[model samples]
Target: MQHDQPRPRRANKSGIRQVLFNSLSFLLIFLPIVLSGFLICRRYGNVQWVFIWLFICSAVFYGAWEPRYIFLLISSILFNYFVAIQLARSKSKPLLAFGIVVNLGSLAYFKYLNFILQTWSSVLGADFQPVAITLPLGISFITFIQIAFLVDVFRNSSDDLGFPKYALFVAYFPHLIAGPIIHHKEVMSQFTNARLAAISANDVVGGIALILCGLFKKVIIADTMASYSTPAFHLAGQLQPISFFDAWGALLAFTFQIYFDFSGYSDIAIGLSRLFGVRLPVNFDSPYKATSIIDFWRRWHITLSRFLRDYLYVPLGGNRHGVLRRYSNLMIVMLLGGLWHGASWMFVIWGGLHGTYLIINHAFHFLKRKIGEQSLSVLIASRLFSLLVFPAVMLSWVFFRSESWQGAKTMLRGMLGYNGILLPERYQAVLGSLNDWVMSTLHMHTGDLVTFGSFRAVLWMILVTAFVFLLPNSQQLLSEFDRSSGLAEDGHLRSRMLAFRPTAISAVVAAGVGIVVLAAIYAGVPSEFIYFQF
Candidate 1:
């Protein structure tokens, strides 16, 4: 979803400007100019000038997509800034409420109006053609950031650093489109004169390391996975049958595809922000490795989870209430969190499914505590993670990725083996009657997900699985270099040998990786990250 433009660019067929982190134009043209301009501004004037320059550059980056929406963005910033200062001065709850309403109102107008229309049409049994409402890119993220700032100000948590700095925080291109959903507390302190003017060698090296690694993830691995996954999903959408092997293969491929895609985007964001000596909150943390739904939420999209906890859950009375209320609150948060990603019932269902998983996970913990020993936590964690959680997560992804409920149902049925297993034609000769039974009873089809052979799909799964489970993440690799790798104290690196060392050999290895990434962008087709639509 971060596949957007920088500066003024010729419009694509969709009328969206054609530049993104994946584009060579961004890599070769835009980033260099912004970085140079930032340094020049920092050198020539005060920190305000630095922020102003960055703010303007950020506007250009965003406006490159649709120049009209830049006005909406600025209007939102100015309105929020004015109200935040007023709320801080007056301590008026009404002022804060008004600010939040207007912001949410803007979001609903652009993002949810079409959704509302369709829902009404269905409910009323009246055909209503949806209105054309072009969503402002990153409206969801922008609204959240501004609302957080306003509330934080009202709470007297973070200082109002004036408009210029605040605008830069909102418009900062790296995390602007898709985000870690940064807190005012996480970034505002780094806006000071001393921090912006200075640069660290480690930041440079680590940042470059992160950006290159992210590029590889997006352009090569994620895109490759997409090729295996998309057609299968499309088949399901078309109401066609999929074999168990094909469905599972496609599901697993998508699981890796989204992970790598978002992980790539997050790394690029953190790394790019790091280049400016500004640290963003960590977004992804090898979520597929998480042992429980609770643990998965803790690891994946961390800042968004934190935001939900702090802003929504706490306000709704959190776990302080009785068990029933706590469970209720959990469902509400998860459902809204799902809707927050996109205005779709599919996302809502995905969120609800996760909510149920969390409730079950929590109930297991509660019941176990009453009946058994605390010592079983780690052992149960491993058992549950492998046997239950991972498979459940993969299952939920069907709804998450599918365009229609029918598609999701088809995929789910396939995974459960109702749609049957795909066996190779060679098995017909080996098994005779059994092969006949396999052909008819198992519903082996010629045009199923893995029609050619299961070999390629199976191999892809192995390679991606190894990359996911074996290797240290970009954050871990850069932890030694960039202090804001956000690796928790308890977190462990898979291998110290994988650590980034500032040596000649490491540089050479990095160069090799970079060249591979460059080759990938040139040779491979460009794809937008999944979250970009949200």
Candidate 2:
């Protein structure tokens, strides 16, 4: 698209944007009232009252996006609950299959219908217009949650789980949109704890701390990085030549942009849930620190990986089958996983690339085992090879971020040096006496190579890398506050110095962070979380 080209209008009344966690509508209005109601209900009334109030507020929170779609969400919950009831009554395979089919069918209709229609029209030269389907907010997450519940009920016959609690499970605002994909078992059990109805001082302080950290990540880091990443990808999408440094800058910038954005949203969600004495599952660990694609999946969007493993992979015979079958299964699962992110071929390619990387990773491991070598060189080789993990994952992200094939190709070409190199002008000063020789011999271009807001974009990548690689994450800092919830009980602790205790110092720090994040939010328009569309 040329700069002056008029934009094409979207289909009529496509969908209403949901309120963002960082948005004023959510922060100033929705959160305080809901938090108060939960505390009030829990204090004076029974646990059931607490659950009921949370569910009602959750419904309002979701319905506020598009009032008409609330029925669709409720209908999904009611329908799934009915199926679970039937499955509990009789352990019928056909009934379970029907329930799964229905859930998937609804998802396909709402999420994939437009993609399919558009593809078919392009292929078959059809003139038919696509249907104006409004994808209800969090439909993907909601559908998967219900499907998982139905499966569990079929397997274990959970007839007495009750409707209100189940409704709370589905409608809960925190994990409802872009989830850590909480299991019904984990959430329901927590809510039932007689002790959970009353709020703990640690939970309150720590939850606020986590929300503050999340706001900082979103408002300060991720949204700021978006200034560079968005335009870079847009330029590539337009098929403009991206210089080498420019492309890699865009790639690394987006990798962290998405990392912080989604993780921030997860932190906020977990914190919000924690406020009500519930803990949503951990969605992100330090995934960029992963040594391989396998480790990456383990750390990133973990609950989704668990879902695929339990519901999809295990059923597909998992590793019980021979190697070839296992590899095929792995590809199928990832391909579907990519498609699950969004109804696009770019996503499919992203999934496929990860699947390939996983296959190669497994192959390398298998070959190493066959060697049976305890030599120092083998150990060093293994460790050095681990370095490829970051670059490999970063490469995959280019495809994930770019919507069109040409755009992704353009970025990839630059990353691989098909595009000419552009050194930062400051680099010329560092080169000193060797500068003239290098300029002539190496053909390096030097100028203003990066731009992000008012600063050079590449400079921020340094801070982003250090923060992801060196600093303790928000959850880790708040580890002492709630040890039993989520991974705090078992996950790695890289540092103790950053522990967020409920001391005066910690209180001051949290307050300072909260003030900074609020100011940032007040200063700019908060961007929607990257994963919300998925």
Candidate 3:
């Protein structure tokens, strides 16, 4: 017996033409963004120009290649769009089932096939070399968003999708690169009624602010740390008696680097969206200050977590089944999530580690609740334990960050006090050259371990971290700086003792402008967003 399939809907000629127009418009819009970079490059002759070119090229290439994968992209979009329409029309269980299968199946193909093949090859000891598959840029995130839309559609929880709005939702340039992973229900309504006009001053200011912030994080903070971390890790096998200090320095630098790099991207995404008068949800909320692993997950890469919970975890029974089943579901979701990051065993292991940690955390909570003696001290102690646990996670990042399995293994072994035995003459020349390069790079004196520059970088990072943690939330700031009073209240004791002043606003604005100018001058070429790997 043959199964009846949902008939493919006839092409909407206007919709197809509009898609083409939208695609072309994106290319045209990017031209000015690129021209600005070219101008900067010509004027400064700096590495910053190289980054701008890289970003511009990546964006343009992806949009151009969308046609090559247009069948898949459009098919996925149509599948969800139609399903949502049908669900909104009536609660149809079959429509929902079909939508879920298609969404999940497409995601698995693009995201997991390589990882699956590799795992099977390793386990079976077979000489299986897979062909290199070109992934659509941002497919990882876009796919997740699509899946969530489908699930919501199935549940009759979403509105009907409009073709133009849906296309823009997926292809919107700012969040398109490294996403806050928007949902259809969240953004589609705005696009439908979008004001098509020249950019406003507020948008211009906000977009510039976001762009500068992203540049500062990627170029000044992340890239500088990468220079030190990359070389140190590369020479891990050669270091003798363990350069523990250097290792710690490199690792810590990388830790902060990834944070700023990712959080900065999210900030830029949100800020840019604001320019369009659409508010994208905040993705990072000082995640480092999170007191528990669960809290950290909620704050860090929050959109991804929301996607997993809504699309993957909940569908697989979540915690609704029994405890054992819930634990199993958590493990499965995390393992898949890890593999989603990359087609590497290291990512799988990373996911599994997080899954295990979460499971244990859940179990502990269960036990504590049963005993009914959970105290503030115990909570504080648990938070401390979680902080200590971060080093292990950081070490796992070596694997995540490495280019190859062998490189990661070598680094790991080096960290564990393993160095291949060799005659003094064998590695002497190589070691000497590496040492000279490092010494010169840092301008190190005879006894000074760190140069003044490195010290200053560290100090700057500390200050940034302090600001991130101590600064009031946006809501709080807005409340304090209420303009109706003709004087903004400063939330400091000294300021309270004195009084508010109109000059305070001008001073703040002047300081902000000065910082932006300084940051732009110091900013290097644009660094690639870290999530681009997935």
Off by over 4 Å in 2: 1-18, 125-128, 157-159, 424-427, 446-456, 488-494
lDDT of 2 at 500: 68
- Please provide, for model 1 over 89-128, each residue's C-alpha lDDT reduced to its tens digit, 9 standing for 90 to 100: 8989888899999999998888888778778777888776
Query: Clashing residue pairs in candidate 2, if any?
Result: none
lDDT, candidate 2, 368-486, per-residue tens? 78875576776777787689999888899887888688888899898877888877657777789999899878778765564432344556778788999998777677666667645
TM-score of decoy 1: 0.91
**lDDT of each candidate versus the true structure:** 0.79, 0.79, 0.57
Better of 2 and 3 by TM-score: 2
Q: How many backbone clashes does candidate 2 have?
A: 0
TM-score of each: 0.91, 0.92, 0.70
Pairs with backbone N, CA or C atoms under 3 Å apart (clashes), candidate 1? 1-529, 1-532, 4-19
Tens digits of per-residue lDDT, candidate 3, 216-329, equal 555556655565565555564233222434555556666666777786677566655655545676677656766556767887788888888877899799999899999999
Q: For candidate 3, which ten residues in a row score worst on lDDT? A: 1-10
Of 1 and 3, the candidate ranking higher by lDDT:
1
